[model samples]
Target chain A: MALTDADLVARVLLDDDHHAFAELVRNHQSSVRGVLRQLTRTDVALADDLAQETFLRAYKNIRSFRGEARFSTWLYRIAYNAFRENARKRKELVGIDEEQLQAEQDTRTVDPALRHDLMHALSLLPLHERSAVLLCCQNGLSHDEAARVLDIPLGTVKTNVLRGREKLKRTLAAWGPN
Target chain B: MNEMTEEDVLDRQLLEAAPYIDDNGFAARVVSRLPAVQRQRRSMRGIILVGITALGSAIAYTLSGGGRFVNEGIVRLSNFPIWLLFVFAFGSGLVVGACAVIVAIRKTPEVRNLRRLQS
Candidate 1:
């Protein structure tokens, strides 16, 4: 029988079994990667580092997961926290140098040659709005699920989704208004 | 211009263009790293255990008779010599530390693929 996430978590917690911990990583890696890629503007290096950090953090804190929700939900929460912490650290490291940071952001702003201008526009959004769109629209997560993953209220999620859509519309409209 | 919103475009484009982002070998790599993490943890535990045992032995020897405990029907290690306790502690610490370092070296990600696999 396939081991449920709860069972794997239980095994790891009880015996510190890395195999069980690995199972958890295997289960949610791709979806985690997908959301992370969108959030970090396909900065694969940063996403990979954060993914590893996320799993490590989860391994350390598995005992605190009370199993009140699905394992993916709990894992998503960890990923979100990892992204938040990394972003905060990045802001601190960059100091008040908006020019350098904006240049970096511009570089990450999707290749113009790629025909997927919509996706490129989505990547340009503020982190919260982009995250809300990815989680709710692309990932098919409900408002409540997105809110839980983002540690925000459902109403905030709704507003972000609305604003994110509006911003993307404006961005794409400037691109020949297709 | 008609009312073709970006959301409408993205909704359709994502359905068609969001190539299933499955990073091949991700699980395998993660699982492969597990044994090393486990070994590191186990060796650290072993090192701690050995250190504690050696310390207890030395403390007990210092607090009581400084004699060597032999296996001649002895039930307690309290009679072990202070010199033996020192030797055992130092030797055990060396062995445990060596094992821990070896495990850590072996576990280092020499061939790890850490790039975000977003294909």
Candidate 2:
């Protein structure tokens, strides 16, 4: 049986167990990377770099995690902050260059059509809505948790998710079932 | 089958479109690149512990009239006979050396236990 995150965290805290931390990294890397990839507007290389930084920061500050949130939620908070900090350093979002994003996406051959539609629609979303949607829909974070991760109010999270979903529905309407 | 809400369907679609990235040695890369954070934390804890201990010792020493005791001992030592003073100095040296050795041995078990647990 897999160990609970608390169990693994206890091992790390009490014994400084690298193996336990590695287990955590492996478990959460996908979602953390995914959220970052979308946030970076499909900048795979930059997203991966930020994901690495997120894990590094997480390791360094693991003691400060108060456990009121789920482990993944805590990781998401770190990942989100890392992305925002990098974006600020790079001087704001500056909007997406969709053509470049498309070129990058083309290099991967997995479910191209659906992934393409999803990425494009996500790009069209307003920043707040996109973050809310990604955290709630794609990353499986609750609205309350998403609010915590994005540092937005819970009401704002709910509003963004509703608006984001409505926009996504219209943008991808051709692909939706009747 | 037809009862799914539009929001539910869209959420399902988004979830499906999101891919799970394979590790492909990502974990190893992260583990390799991690700083010596645990070691840094341990050393920091040790520093704080030492600082607190030194402060406590200073306060206790002052409260116990340690300086006066040392001064009185020195004055008394000067008054002792030469042979008795030599014996007193030798015994004091042995006692201090034994206390140092005992403190060193007491720290060894903590390290041994850590190694045993990790193994």
The number of clashing residue pairs in each candidate reads 1, 0
List, residue by residue over A1-178, the lDDT tens digit for candidate 2: 8987777776776677889999999999998998888888789999999999999899888777756788899999999899989998998656445464355445534333877788777866767788999999988889999999999999999998998888787767744455
Per-candidate alpha-carbon RMSD to the true structure: 12.8, 10.5
- What lDDT tens digits, residue by residue, belong to model 1 across residues B1-119? 34456466666665454546565777666555443445577789999999999999888777666634443325444578878878988999999999998886556322121111111
Chain A TM-score, prediction 2? 0.85
Cα deviation in Å at residue A151, candidate 1? 2.0
lDDT by candidate, in order shown = 0.70, 0.82
TM-score of chain B of 2: 0.40
**B53 Cα displacement, candidate 2 (Å):** 7.6
Which docking class does model 2 fall in?
acceptable
Choose the strongest candidate by DockQ.
2
**Top candidate when judged by TM-score against the true structure:** 2
Q: Write the per-residue lDDT of candidate 1 for residues A1-178, one digit (tens) a residue.
A: 9977766766775568877777778778877877777777789878877777777777767656766556677777888889888888778223324364356445654445424676677677777788888877777777898899999999999998888788776666566424
Docking quality (DockQ) of candidate 1: 0.12
